[model samples]
Target chain A: MITAERKPLDEIIAMILPFKKVLVVGCASCVGECAAGGEKEVGLLGSALRMDARMTTKELETREMTLERQCVYEFIDRLTGLIDQYDAVLSLACGAGVQAVAEVFPNIPILPALNTSFLGQTKEAGLWLENCRGCGDCRLHLFADICPVTRCAKQIFNGPCGGSQDGKCEVNPETPCAWHLIVTRLEDRNQLDLLEEVYAPADWSKKEGAGPRKIVREDQQN
Target chain B: MKIESQLKNVLAAGRFAVTAECGPPKGADPEAVIKKGRILKGYVDSVNVTDNQTGVVRLSSLAACVLLLQEGLDPVLQMVVRDRNRIALQSDLLGASTLGIRNVLCLSGDHQSFGNQTQAIGVFDLDSIQLIQTVRRMRDEGQIIGGEAVSPPPYLFIGAAANPFADPFFYRVIRLAKKVKAGTEFIQTQCIYNLDRFKEWMSQVRDRGLHEKVYILGGITPLKSAKMAEYIKNQVAGMDIPEPLIRRMKSVPAKGQRKEGIKISIETIQALKEMEGVHGVHIMAIEWEEAVPQVVEQAGLMPRPTV
Candidate 1:
């Protein structure tokens, strides 16, 4: 899921200062799972904004609401009536969700309260680890399910590089060397022969090399 | 036979070869490279000019190799894939060839975080194996990576690094085989302190008959002091230094440590000379090129072989 962290309180406050009345919107999807832009976080932010207004002697009003999903047009329509009641919409969603809100309410300025991090999994409580680079092409099977493109520091195909030691990466001692894991696991399965063949250079055009990528299924798009 | 490589000829002649490394200075001074090249001129078969070794920015290996060529020494141009994309790598290969560089060593350089520029973004567009293939294609097939025809493709001898001590001990030989399959003609290993492990790696290579397909050069670096030994054993990544080697260094007095280090390196060279499938010894006397000649002579490898 897409993960994010709320921007510092000062940056958010500075962004909302010009608007006397602000609508704080949260998404209950990816951001909610990561506990960054869930309904509870929206409530907390709303109270903090109210406190700032009282301490600064400013006539500011904050109304908090959480949508089932922010990226879908159907769920974003829920804010159509409430958007006009506020000066600006402060979105506590990922970049895609913020853009979706902006598309739905083209006139109202959309502000992002959280910084979208990466496509990752919550490895454990309070720890999120990025597992995918969204490179468009995926070859996880050949590497024993480990993504060298995202995990290896050099993104080396024919590795582990010389910097690998004790199953740890030279870049960071804490991070496990992806190639080491691949080799060791494959050897256990009697599949070490898979690494014998030199991997060819990646066709990066499938990723950002050609520019922003898009896909359209002719049968499902209409 | 594919390229005019003095180092290749020395190895092909079945003579035990000796190679040394020359690191480029940090500043834009040609004198440093020239001085080191002069020191290693007649002592070794070919000199490898390091490419931003340890990720520290320095004079380029290409320019340093050119200086060595001017000093009447055969140079092995070390090219790292960390800072250049395929286009730039190919362009530099052509440039190096045009500048009279005949041998090339391909490597995935040390991570930039280990260098002065910790925040730098490494441009590993192609890994070392792919770089070797690219060079081979350019040299043998006369085609660029994009399949464009070159008017005159670069004729070069390709070399790649191997670490027998790095993790998954069983996979190290397989990695070397992969490099050989990728068109690398020679293999230069990381410095050897644990001779037992290196011999195990070589035994595996011989088991697969990979030694006949590619030349293996064992790496040796003389430790200047016990402190340096400790730093290498603890701080240097992927290094497998036996505790006894450091103990030996500490056993000597402060002033005698340098001589003791040279003696240790000479012993390693002598041991490597008798090992089957071992083509040569690459003494990477890091920052101590002057000690190379004395080490080479003391190892009884002097009166350099002319192929």
Candidate 2:
């Protein structure tokens, strides 16, 4: 899932300095799973903003609302009549959700409360690790299911790099070297020869380079 | 022979080759490299000029190799893919070759986090295996990675590093074979303290008939002190210094431990010479290049083999 984290409290407070009325919008998807921007986080941020307004003797009217999925038009349409009352909408969602809201309501100022991190997996409670780079092409089959493009510190297709010591990446001892795991696991399965040839340089054509990548379902469009 | 390097010639002539390493200075000091070369001169077949080894920035290996050449010492230029993309690596290979460097050792170097700059980016455009293949194509086929032709291609005796003690020990030999299949003419291993494990790895190498395909050099680093021994055993990554060696160093008094370290290194070389599929020994006297002559002399490999 796309992961995100709430921006620093001070930065968010400063972003709303000029606004008298504000809407804190939350997404119940990826950000909620990562605990970065959920309904609870929206309440926490709204309470902090209200406390700041009271302390500074400012007239600040803040309203909190969470959609089932902020990236969807139907869910965003739930706030159709109410969104025009706020000076700005602070979105506690992934970048997609913020952009979706902006596309629907261009008249209102859209502020991002959460910083989109990566497509990641939760290692355990309270810990998230990026597992996919969304390189558009996947070679996880060759690496024994460990994604070297995202897991390896250098994203080396032909590894383990000399810096991989004792199966741990030199960049961080806590992180396991992706190739070490790939090689050993492949060896165990009696398929060590799979990594013999040099992997061609990654094809950049499939990547989301300068613009947003979109896939059109031509068969379903009609 | 495919490449005419002293080390390659000595290895091909069915003689045991002795190689040493000399790290470039962290500052602009060619004199320091020359001084180290003088000590290594006539004592080893080739001296490896480390390329920002251990991710610590120093004088460029290409420049250091040139300085070693000026001092009449053959330099095996070590090039790592940690800092350069394919464009830089290919151009650097050509530049080093134009400057009369005949030997090259390609590797995916130590991570930048371990160096002075912890936040540096690593550009491993090609790992060691691919780097070896790239050099071979440039030499044998006059082409770059994708077989694009180059005018007057660089001819170099390619070398790659192997870690027999790395995890999943069974795959170590397979990795060596992959590197050999990638077109490396020679192989140098990580520093050795346990001869038994190295012998096991060599047995695996020989079983695969790789002995006849490439020259395998066993790496040996002389311990400077018992503290260094403990540090290597406990702290250094991928190096497997045996407990007995550490005990032997600790058993001795502080003054005599360096000698003991050299003694153990000599014993390892003597044993490695007899081991099947082992072609030579690479004496990595880290920061202790002056001890090269002493170690070579004591190892009975003195007055190094002539090409």
Candidate 3:
């Protein structure tokens, strides 16, 4: 899930302060799951904004709309005719959705109403914690299903660093040492011998720094 | 005294009764819900058990409230008409009454797009005002929506929400009036961080005699850290943190600032308690329920009012 938190009420108010007619757009995908840019948040934000505007003696004509997935072109096309109805759009989607909206409606200003945090899972209900960095490489197989790129303090690719103490990271005691977790998992699976294999430095070319990556599936392509 | 009798006395005495909200658990675990109910039992006259709050699936508020009632706590079963139609709402209401749940907070819940189940469809057959009216019809007229005489209509202390800080401030007062007209006996507003603005709204309510008809509870939540304060300020709608308060939050070092957060919360409660037209503080510590007792104590309020 794309974890996002609501943008500050004042910041949101300032973003749409100049607009009379505004549409609060909610994404029904990742942001929604994180409870940030979902329909409920849209209503809450819209209602809160409306209340704030009323308190300020300003009249705001606010309407709310939620798409199945804001990142998809098909969903973006849903707002084609409705584009001109609002002065601006407060997109409650993730960064991807916001960009998608901006790409589709070049004329309208698309404002993000949420701060896209990171790729995370719900640790518990109403609580989501980050777990992945999307480093564009799948090294979980090499590390017994743990991604050192995200869990490690220094993003170490090999064995535990000196900062690792008793299976806990020294930088933050609450966080477990990623290498320790890897070692424990490898030991459990009887694959501790894999630790002997020295992996080369990560190839940055195949990662995000190389630019936008693409996957072409001949079976699915027209 | 029973909450109803106390409420009546408070009303006659021209004082406001305080109420707070508690969202039910998302799963079968009732520990959090039970603890919240117990924590708020004597501190608040009524605790609102939100029904699948924000459209998120949870243990039914009715069931949670039943447990609270068993513990000798007053539970206000918050029914969101967004998911349930008239039939289900009425059935739940009558069922609650039969189970001795006397308070209810009617809301048009968050749309299904906000919950774990995005494909879920919303059933907003009635908005909050309409739900209040429906409850009133059932209570006062002893008639259901179908006009059939309900053998015994449920008597409930109905509550609703008012966002004084909602944009277009004029509409806030207008909405409150509408809710009152529709049968809201009490209103628990969104978080109150901007007391000046809240006071202005209260003055308007007072001038319009709206305060006379309904008790108002101020919603408050303590910031656990500067980051949390920033989050609430930026992300949480209907929540406003003044610059001074923000500065105070920021002054505390990140490592050991939880104590500072508690102090800030205590101060907020103390200030809110002294504010005119502010009946009581609804401490929404969110996950910080343990600090509520200290806040109430610091604010010089008895955990339970002797009156």
Candidate 3 segments whose C-alpha is farther than 4 A from its true place: A1-222, B1-16
lDDT of each: 0.92, 0.87, 0.76
Which model scores highest in DockQ?
Answer: 1
Chain A TM-score for each candidate, in the given order?
A: 0.96, 0.95, 0.94
Give the per-residue lDDT digits (tens) of candidate 1, residues A84-193: 99999999999999999999899999999999999999999989998899888899989999999889999999999988899999999999999999998888788878
What is candidate 3's lDDT per residue for A10-66, written digit by digit as tens?
A: 899998988999989999899888888888989999999989988889989999989
TM-score of each: 0.96, 0.92, 0.56
- Write the residue-wise lDDT of candidate 1 on B46-83 in tens digits: 99999999899999999999888888888999999999
Residue pairs clashing, model 2: none
Q: Ten consecutive residues with minimal summed lDDT in candidate 1 chain A? A: A205-214
Evaluation by TM-score, superior candidate among 1 and 2: 1
Q: What order do you get sorting by lDDT, best first?
A: 1, 2, 3
* Candidate 2 structure quality by residue, lDDT tens digits, B1-307: 1246889899999999999999999999989999999989999999998999878989999999999988887889999988998889999999988888999998888878788877788877676777888899899999987678997999789999999887657667777888888899999999989888988888888899998899999998999999999998777778888898899999999999989989999899999988888899998998898777888899899777777
Predicted model 3 interface RMSD: 26.8
